[model samples]
Target: MRCETIREALSARIDGEPEPVAAGSADRHLDACADCRSWYRRAESLQRTLTARPGPPVPDLTADILRRLPPDWPLSSVP
Candidate 1:
């Protein structure tokens, strides 16, 4: 498989979403390509870090703030 093809499949392999044939092809390419292997390791590391972190807390908006907003004000206008 070409480097680009393997790189495209790398994420699917990491996510366990690729079919066995594609995954095997990516694995074979990774074994032969040092750059792709590094990329795969980095992808795995990022996935692990993100999965380990806690999700962001929900914001607490008071009724007073809601009341102060114009009736026609769109939520998209906010930051």
Candidate 2:
């Protein structure tokens, strides 16, 4: 199987979606392909890193935004 096809399967599997290629075939390719193995490792690591973060807090700016608006601005028109 082409590396692209196997990579697609790997990505699908990582995302909990159906794999484009059979698991056994993709596994066999990954076993013999160093590059694909490396790609898969990086992809998994990235997913873990992204999902593990407690992201920075976002400050609520609704009041500040409203205050800056023109006094005569119609509230109904804002939307």
Best by TM-score: 2
TM-score of each: 0.62, 0.76
How much RMSD separates candidate 2 from the native structure? 2.0
How many backbone clashes are present in model 2?
A: 0
lDDT of 2 by residue, 1-79 (tens): 8999999999999999999878999999999999999999999999899999899999999999999999898999766
Deviation (Å) of 48 in candidate 2: 0.8
Q: Could you give the C-alpha RMSD of every candidate to the true structure, in order shown?
A: 5.3, 2.0
Clashing pairs in 1: none
Model 1 agreement with the true structure over 1-79: per-residue lDDT tens digits:
7777777788777787854455667777888899999988999999999989998997777777878898998979778
lDDT of each: 0.80, 0.95
Candidate 2 stretches greater than 4 Å from native: 72-79
